[model samples]
Target: MAVPRQSEAQEYIEKQRIMELFDNITAQLVFHRPDNPKTFMIDYVEKLKESRTTQLDFPCLFDESNIESVFGMLDPTKKGFITSEQYKESTQTLGCDNVDPSPAGSDMDMITQDTFRREVKTGLKKASATFEQV
Candidate 1:
């Protein structure tokens, strides 16, 4: 069976739902660290900036720019990788509870650049899917 087109009311409701989700994400980020706090980690601050940019409608799509931004957040040392702990912490902070802390065949302590991107993209795709279903 073909899916029916969304009505104007349905579209408006979807928009409202998206707005609410972004608002909550913003509040969570701020609660974790206020704007321009000196003691706040630069990584967290950058993530906050990304979220704010997304909320401001800067193409929330997981494109090259967004992917690179998130990668930089995870690889702040510029060492080309992040620890599994960092991965877990970052995902959890962003309300992504579906990420497995320990995926098979990977060292649970050290996450390589490739692994980081793959896992993050997976999470983003899952989040998008869930949001679309709203």
Candidate 2:
């Protein structure tokens, strides 16, 4: 059966959802860096095919301290936040080639500490749900 065409709004929402998924997947790959990349990739793909709702166990707890440390690094001035330029510069200074310098999520200009913490928690939740315990 042919599916009905999606409206522009629907398309935009779908794109946003896909982007968020990719962001979550990227976080998992980068932060976790599974011991066996090939096996992890194969398993991850297979799991996705089987069910996007698949739940996987994560060995480590997503601690707030880790999030705070990262945010502190990004906000060296202790101004309680980091602008896009600062984020870009700091990441570059740290030699993070894969990370995007721009502020992530809905905020395109700056990232407050609270926002950063929330995002980190959300990403950790996504990673926990999407990845398997090894």
Candidate 3:
């Protein structure tokens, strides 16, 4: 018996997650707002390729600024903190299923920006490690 081969489109786009590649590219473009988008994208893609070849994904390219933006969107009033519920919902929405919504060594009801960033960083690292193992 012979195994059937997938169509080129399915093999590349579905198996390789091309849509996710484009989505991340677009998100980075919006975040950076570079003067020359074409060059920026080329460089970005090159770095992504390098990271993949090295078996590293760099935590989905989320930087301090991106974390800050997410915190700001959740807090809205610059309150310096958000409720634990908000943190949980946002993390889940961001596909961080393994992250604990409540920050460690803090009141379970509220999460500060620093705490959120730290927890998210830790979680992303763990998630990346898990992905590499798979």
> Every model's Cα RMSD, please?
11.1, 9.3, 5.2
Candidate 2 structure lDDT = 0.57
Model 2 spans > 4 angstroms off: 1-62, 85-108, 131-134
Among these predicted structures, which one has the highest TM-score? 3
Candidate 3 structure, TM-score to reference? 0.53
Better of 1 and 3 by lDDT: 3
Instruction: Write down the worst ten-residue block by lDDT for model 3.
Output: 125-134
Clashing pairs in 3: none
Q: For residues 1-134, what per-residue lDDT tens digits would candidate 3 score against the true structure?
A: 56556686576566565665677778778878999999998987776666666755553656679888999999898888888888888777665666864475347577888888877776654443322233
Model 2 steric clash total: 0
Put down candidate 1 lDDT per residue, 19-111, tens digits, no spaces. Answer: 545654555456666565444444434554464546432222355566667769878879877777777887665545566677532574677
In model 3, how large is the Cα lDDT of residue 63? Answer: 63
lDDT to native, each model: 0.58, 0.57, 0.70
List clashing residue pairs in candidate 1. Answer: none
